[model samples]
Target chain A: MNSHLILRTVSKFLIPLIVVYGLYVHFHGDFGPGGGFQAGVIVAAAVVLYALIFGLDACKVAVPPSWIRIGMTTGVLLYVGTGVVTWLLGGAFLDYDVLRNNPDHPAGQHLGIILVELGVLFTVATVMVAIFYAFGSRTPDISDEDW
Target chain B: MLNLINAAAAQAGNVPPTLIIDICLMAMLVVVAFAIVRIRSLFAIVMLQGVYSLLSAAWFVSLDAVDVAFTESAVGAGISTVLMLSAMLLTDRKSAPVPVKKALGPLMVCVLAGAAMFYAIPDMPAFGDPDSPANTGPGMEYMTASVKQVEVPNVVTAVLASYRGYDTMAETVVIFMAGLGVLLLLGLNGNAGFWQAKVQGQNICTQAAPRARILTSPSDKPNTEPRAPGDPEPSSKNTSVKKVAAKKTAARKTAAKKPATKRTTSKKAAKKPAKPKGEAS
Candidate 1:
């Protein structure tokens, strides 16, 4: 098989698996060692690999810059929104127990963990992609004029 | 005394496997650092810099700082490498090889500082002592309590956003300033008319929107006349004729409006006779 086709086929299956593993690591952090940051990087790494094997242009077609910007903003908003919700419910910022009427329930911890992990994933993935664009993209003016 | 020194050497050689591996990695790091400095080729030096980041990530992993290791691998190995590559493309890829310079004053200062740090480490907590005063500090208490009370599983986020939120805000402001600086350097704000003139001339986006019809006729009318290279083509003449026809149509519409308005006033006067007779009846 050609390299591009092979990469396409592999990424089709690989990205979802990486995302699932990232979510597992994110949720399992309280019991195990891995957490939001690690999960975020893992998922971002998988996407970066996809970008590397395929051309940057093709990679961009798959996930455009606008979508990445939105994802990053959504992640930060989710984290902030959770805090605001807790604050509104008569608790300090990020106080998880205030998410529900029942303070003793473990559901708040679950909800808080999921939201923070999603935010971490969003920020890490977008920043990775943005930095990639910064260094990889060359203006035609700069590129055409050989230094 | 000779026997005692030999025995000590033998015991050192029998150090645990993990310690041996750590020593090996440290030695490799030293070799990489020396190579980075001594290498004459700029291209090779840039590649070695990326290698250095990967090695550092490995060290973090060995130290059980997985989060830090992941960040280093992604940012250092990935992002920094891309940045260095871009910089390399912008300039000449060769370095002038010079003999090693004399390192007298700064080298001595660095060595002395390193020695002082080594001396200070002995008074700090032993490798992994859980009950050490350093480990039992209020920071540790905060970390433990924050996990249960703050509700976020990621203590880093809690500490960064809630406990030390002001610092995060300041960092964000710095990032915003940097973005603004980049925009200023790129001249995005200068000569607002530059984009306006280009847009008005081309009308590319105007065609996409319904409201942009205001920009269509006048601008496109003159510009599209020269599209045909040869007048021998029948379609070219027909299109030019169509343009003339459109201008005639516009003139006729303007001409027709005044007469239509006058006709309406005359029609109203004619209708007054019918209205008066109906009122009399």
Candidate 2:
């Protein structure tokens, strides 16, 4: 696949753009349609596309599966940690209004939402990639001729 | 021309464009569903499922559920397709023949579920009705206050990440658990592990590069060593040989500089008939 000039060129061109779009969707989620889940899936799709074109070995080198596992754990921890922070601040669990000094301010909510969405993004993307890796790692039970 | 078109669209009324798009998408979805049900090939079914997701995504956009549409398009159409294809790589492409009697029970269950859903539909309020229980109550309060409270333009995100944060957190945990389940079931062999070791001539655990090279090189050229009497028939050997040859050609095309010894180990592994069958089952 590396030697396939057309595929290599097109994927090289497209992958960065897809990744950028994923980020854009993630950040702009507050103002628009997309958010963590959609952005995560889109980003995972970009990685999957890279794996498909460049082969799984090359992809593993680029984004190690161990890192993906860590990311999956970290995202959930981030989400839970945010809640714990809110609790420490003397608010109810996941109550963003009390995250900052002023309970009535919207700025705290904004910060809280961003952090939570980021957590969601990380977990969703890494979990998706992990699932892809799991499936790709297995050898086929049946041969192509059997198909 | 723009004015004329605008006038024509205005004359056609609010329903035409949305109705047309809705009908087209729904009709296509129905067709794809039928095609999926009728298809025997698992590969085609997977492709059709992707199409189904895309169609539903379009429908979600039409319904003004852009966030839902975005999620559907990315997760349903994109990631799911790739995941399913990866899964198919390890499994048979053809679905097994099913007896009518075996399928009947599931069919009845589906029909009953569908009927119950249909029975409940009329009792539900009309779509977007402001006075509806959903649109009134807390939902209306959220819509009114979310902008001022969350300061996010997209209410869905605000609600999902903040207002209903606990639910979203649980959902994230569910996804995390799902990934954990797959890892536990399949084992963490995604890296340069046993599968890649077979094809790439690199020991996953030991990282014994030189030994891998030696093992791979000899395995490539025809094994002059006498075969054991208990070995399987020559036909299986031929199939393994053909597969190795094909893999070699592919590797050569893509990675000319890579050592030819890479695929030989996999060929030898494939020849061990009992191992793969036992693992698969």
Candidate 3:
């Protein structure tokens, strides 16, 4: 499988671009047809493509399953933490209105939306990669030729 | 080019110009569905299912639900295909054929469902109807409020991340829990202790790198991961990232297993060689 020079070379070229596009989709969501979930999926797809070309062990080394566990927790925390912060800031739960207080500015809402979306991005992406690892790491009872 | 423009103008009387595309996508979707039902090969079925999703995503785009289209393509067409393929690797390639009588009941159910859909459609608003119930009521309110409060250009993002932030957070939590559940059921490996080993290794490396450094040669990167487990013998614990390292660990483990297999064989051979015949009750 390592003999697949074409796939290896092509993926090496494409993965960075894919990741950049995912970030673009994330940041541009406020003005376009994309969001955190889509961005996360796109980024995870890059990692998955790398895993497919390389092997599961190599990917585990690169992304490290331990980090994935941490990422899953971190993303959830970041999301919920925003709401808790909003609550602590004297607005209702997830009320982005209190995130910042320039009396005439929409800055609070903008900041809140970005933080929460970032959180969504993290959880969705890491969960996707974790699930991929679970499936890919299996020593399949069936083989490629059989399938 | 003129004929194309004329065609667009002709169809622009009331229907959208993309109506042909909608029809074509729908027809392909039906064909793919039937192919999925008829195909015995699970691999082909999985591929067709992905194609089905892609077609539907295109249909969503045509219907102006671009946000939904984005999600459908990413989740359904992209990741679902990969996950399904990986999962299908665990099972046989072909699906068992259902008996005609068994399928007949499902066919009746499908017929009834399709009939109900058609029956309901007449009472529903036409596609993209501006005055539809969904377009009015709370929808208008959200649209207006989103502009005034969030100042976000995309109302979908505003609604999802602002107005319905709680629901989205819950969904994120749900995904997190799903990951945890999968890890628990699968054990990150088919074994019980690998995840524990990896986590312990990380803490060791981070907390005491200098002390841990004394135990390994520069080349023993695999040793780093397996050292912290302390469960397997030191020799068999070279679970490195490289393929060579993996093979070395596997060979070591197998060597350790050789005598265990021999003992099992000896135990089986020592069992009584008595044969008994049973009569049907």
For DockQ, the strongest prediction is 3
Kindly give the stretch of ten consecutive residues in candidate 1 chain B with the minimal lDDT sum: B207-216
Q: lDDT by residue for model 3 over A45-91, one digit each (tens)?
A: 98888888876656666777777788888888988999999999999
Cα lDDT of model 2 by residue, B64-144, tens digit: 988888888898889888888877765577898765666888899999999999999999887678789877789888888
Query: What TM-score fits each model?
Result: 0.62, 0.73, 0.76
DockQ score for model 1, please? 0.13
Against the native chain B, what TM-score does each candidate's chain B reach?
A: 0.57, 0.61, 0.64
Candidates 1 and 2, the one with greater TM-score: 2
Ranking by DockQ: 3, 2, 1
Among these predictions, the greatest TM-score belongs to 3
lDDT of 1 by residue, B1-281 (tens): 64665565578886554455566678888999999888877778888888888888888877777767766876687656765765575455677778778989999999999999999998887666888986788779777887666655656655654565445434433433443343333221111111223555765322221110011133123222333565544446567566645753453344335432132222222111111122211
- Quote the lDDT for B85 in model 1: 62
Residue pairs with colliding backbones in model 2 are: none
lDDT of each: 0.57, 0.74, 0.74
Q: What clash pairs does model 1 have? A: none
